[model samples]
Target chain A: MELITWPDERLRRVADVIDVFDKALREQASKLEAVMRAGPAAVGIAAPQVGWLQRLVIVDVTARKGTNNGLLILLNPEIVQWQGSVIGREGCLSVPEYTGNVVRAAELVIEAQDLYGESCRYEASGFEARVIQHELDHLDGLLFTDRIVSRRSDLFLRQGGA
Target chain B: MAEHWFMLTVVGRDRAGIVAQLAQTLFRAGADFGEASMLRLGGNFTIMLMVHFPAGEHSLAESIKAVAEHLQLRVHIDPIDSHLHENEAADVVVSISGADQAGIVAGVTTRLAAVGLDILNLDSTVAGSEASPVYVMRIEGRAREGIEALEPVIAELQREGLDAVLHPVDMLIA
Candidate 1:
């Protein structure tokens, strides 16, 4: 599946409410997984990147997890509660090759739906929390670049790495 | 189609209308300030911008030079190969523990900078233990080509009495 392009009006479109658990939805989820895997380093993907615009995202912080571990599939995810504030650099597969500092909740408990249509709750902190929140923003058609808080003199556009 | 993406940063004493003046320059040049995060650190204002233009048509260095001179600000601009992009880079974990001191970051980053390493996450903590204060730091970054030779740099850091470790991070594809 071809990833959606930037400034594609579709990217800004709020995802459709996905209220069903069916074979087709699962197929779409698989397609998102494929797209995420196709990138050099993609941790998660939302349905919108594949042009579906559904309120669904899949995040598995397993690779970067030190203790907290689980695959998170959030449908219609919402940041139900948050505390404190922190800044972290983030990059997105949909936006391709640019990373920026984004201000996000230091800790968040998100209420969302799973692929099985089951309600799920996630409490995340540090990198895991940041990644989940980043992908969830995509469900609302938001990008990491949209969340930056500083314009420092040291950020570089990288090139030519493995 | 060649698309050019550049990370542009401006840092200097905080004053009035710096963002306005700098943004004006970029807009006049037909380059899109794709993304930006900026804040005032102490009395200095810093900005990180992801700017883009169609590749094969213009040089990012020239654009950065024009903007830097016009805005009268310190600027650093580097070209991001469209192929390597953001997601294609390799991640490395770096942990550093040392006596509280300045230039610990500078010492480590200076070496990584020479090799085109991109820092992804950096955390530094200096804690008071009621006895001996401890300073510790950990960073995640992506390595460019020739970064494998940084073992010597790590060895040098170890000599500074700072415990340092560098390991490649394998990203799991979704």
Candidate 2:
């Protein structure tokens, strides 16, 4: 699946909830997971990023150094609780050539559904929580640029993948 | 007409409509710019921009003369070699804070250079009252190697009597 870049009208629209856990929806999840797994640098991907309007996301940080829940396929995820705040630099596939410092919850408890439509709650902190927050924001039509600490100082021109 | 890049700067006492006036003048003058930075320091406002203008005998100074005089602002425009430039990527975020002292910038920058780190961006300021003051500086720099080559930098900076911390660049997220 081709990822949608920034300024695309589709990326700005809120994604629709996945009410049906059918084969097509599962196939979409696999496509998103394949996209995430294909890139050596990518850690997460959202439904809107792949031109889908449904609420689905894939997050896997095992390739890098971090405490994670392995590969997670969250359907219609919601943040039940969040705590603390920390500013961290973030880069997005949709918004290429730039990275910005964004303030996110240092820790959060997310309630989401697995691909099988089973409810699951995960308490995440550190990098895992940051990836989840970044991916979830896409569902609401919010990019990291919208949450940057300061446009003048926080935004930077990306040199490499990082 | 041949297109040319020029570095433009406007400085004056902080007031309203400065940006609007400058922008309107530049727009009317047919000066196009894509990136610029403006900030207020010590009650004075300064603007720095790279303007793309068609090269001609008449100068930009003559074009903005009316607005500059009316606002009592200083303006300068110089030709640039090229508009396309490479921006440095930061490998780590560095923070330094301590009691206000002279040559802190020079000292820290010298140390960074010696360690082969190129500074991408930096902001420094002195805060507090007349009796006491604090110097705080934040820097984004490119490290030749990874964080392993960076850990020693903070140790030497702290030895010079300043609090320092270095954090690796944030992970790449999809």
Candidate 3:
């Protein structure tokens, strides 16, 4: 599937909460997984990114770097607690041409629902935490560009073909 | 009414209500602002704005001149192509800092141009005391061919006694 990249109005819409978890939602998650894997180095994907305006997100930092819960397909995830903050560079499949520095919680305890509609809690830190925060922003109609570290750091120069 | 785009520049001594004055004038003239950059250097405030004015009637220049004269600011308004884009994402961010010296901007930028880097934004200034000033510059630009092309530029800049570092746009993805 061609990923929806920048300036697409759909990416800016706040997602609806996932309700009535069922086989259909599971299939949608699976399709989203395929899209994520198909992307170049995409660690997480949100439902709104694929044009599904529901609060569903998939994150798998697994073995790539940092300690992680492997694969998490969360619906309506919420961060119950957070601690520490670190700035890291981030790019999105939705916003392909730009990467920016964003400050995120270094550690977090998130409450979420699994694909089977079971409540799950995870204590995540480091790279895994950053990926979750980045994906989570998509649910609220925010992008990495919106959260870039500073005004001085957010400079963009006009180009002929831009 | 069709949109007529213009790039407006205003430079004058820093004073209170400068931004409000410009905003009020634009609002009254029914002008929509696009991307803009405003900064105060030393004692002067400078503004660069992309203005979108409905062109069915009315003199945009005359309206702008009245406000500029009242504010006692030097003003330049130039028509821009309707297809003109606001900006492009910078592919590389380069920062260099060292003891203050002459020709730093010119020498470094000339090398950047020779290496095919199209600068989008650059800010350079002196820091520290008058006797021991440090020249620091941050540049955001596009390396059209590829970032790999910047390898030698970085090396050369480093060789010249300046601390230079390059960060590629795709350094991280999540």
- Residue B70, candidate 3: how far off, in angstroms? 2.3
The residue-by-residue lDDT of candidate 1 on A1-162, one tens digit each, is 778867787888888888898888888788778787787667777888778888988777676747453777788889989987655556666775655556767788988877788888878886677777887777787877777664221221111010
Better of 1 and 2 by DockQ: 2
True contacts kept of each: 0.25, 0.55, 0.38
- The digit string of per-residue lDDT tens for model 3 on B116-167 reads 8999888877877999999988888899778788889889888988988787
Local accuracy of candidate 1 as per-residue lDDT tens digits, B1-174: 236777787887888888887787677777776556687775778898877766423465565576566556787776654333434334665677777777877888887767767786665667657477667666667776655766777788898788777765432222
Cα deviation of A52, candidate 3, in Å: 5.2
On residues A1-162, what C-alpha lDDT tens digit does candidate 3 reach at each position? 346767888789989887788998898899999999988778899988888889999998774745689999989999999999866667788876566677889899999998888999999997889899999999999999998865444342111111
Query: What TM-score, to 2 decimals, does candidate 2 have?
Result: 0.89
Rank candidates, TM-score, best first: 2, 3, 1
lDDT per residue for candidate 2 within B73-98, as digits (tens), equals: 99887777553434445777777889
Q: What DockQ results for candidate 1?
A: 0.18
Return the clash pairs for model 3, or none: none
**Candidates arranged by DockQ, highest first:** 2, 3, 1
Candidate 1 residue A21 C-alpha distance from true site, Å: 2.4
Query: For model 2 chain B, where is the 10-residue window of minimal lDDT?
Result: B80-89
